[model samples]
Target: MKVAVVLNPIAGGGRLKRHWPEVAASLKRHFGDFELRETQAEGDAERLALDLAAIGFELVIAAGGDGTASEVADGLLKAFRESGRT
Candidate 1:
C-alpha cells in the first residue's frame, strides 16, 4: 500500500530531520511506495494530511510530536467524516 509520512521540520528539535534518511529507508522496507512531506509552517502538516486523505490515501503517517500528530489526525478524521465513511 502507499504510505504518506507527514513530518514536521521543527519537530523533536530537528531530530526527525536528522533521522529522516533512516526513517525513509525503514519505511520503504514495509511499503511498496511512500511519500514524505515536511511541514513548511505551523499548519502545513494538517493541510497536507487532509489533502492526502481527500485524495484517498489509505495510510497517512505523522512523524512528529504529539501536537503535530494531533493535527494530522484531526485532518484525516475531518476528511473521513466529510467523505461519509466514518
Candidate 2:
C-alpha cells in the first residue's frame, strides 16, 4: 500500500521527535517504505494529508497528538468531500 506519515516534530514536548527513529524503524519493518512529511506549523499536517489523499495514497498516518490526528482527519475528509466520495 502507498502510505504517508504526517508527523508533528514538536508534539508532546518533542517526545515524538526523540522516539521517531525507533518508531520509523518499526513502521518500515511492518509496512515497508512510506512517505514522511513533518509539520512545520499548525496547518501543515492538514495540507499534507489532503495532498497525500488526493494523490492516491492508500494510507495516511498522523504521528502526533490528538490535535495533529484531528487535523489529518479533517484534511482527508476534505479531500473526500472534494472528490465527491463522502
Candidate 3:
C-alpha cells in the first residue's frame, strides 16, 4: 500500500524534527515504506496533502497537532470537491 506522510517539522517546538529518524523507522516497520513530505511553513502540509491526494494517494497521514490534521482534512476535502468525487 502506498502511504503519504505529511510531517510538520516545527510541531511541538521541533520535537518531531528531533525524533524523526526513529519515528520514520517505526513507521516504516509498520507501513513498510512511505513518501515523506516535510512542511516548509504553515499550511504547507495542507497544500502537500492536496497535491498528493490529487495524484491518487490512497492513504495520507498527517503529523502534528489538531491544526495540522484539520488543514490536511480541508485540503483533501477541497481536492475531492474540486474533482467532483462523491
RMSD to true structure for each model, in Å? 1.0, 0.7, 1.1
Could you estimate the TM-score for every candidate? Answer: 0.93, 0.96, 0.91
lDDT (tens digit, per residue) of candidate 1 on 65-86: 9989999998998898899887
| Per-model CA lDDT versus the true structure | 0.88, 0.96, 0.88
Per-residue lDDT of 80 in model 2: 93
TM-score of 1: 0.93
- Tell me which residue pairs clash in candidate 3: none
Per residue, candidate 3 scores C-alpha lDDT tens digits across 20-75 of: 99999999999988999988888888899899999988788988878889888988
TM-score between candidate 2 and the true structure = 0.96
Collision count of model 3? 0
Q: Could you tell which candidate, 2 or 3, scores higher by TM-score?
A: 2
Which residue ranges in model 2 land beyond 4 Å of their true spot?
none
What's the lDDT of the predicted structure labeled candidate 1?
Answer: 0.88
RMSD of 2: 0.7
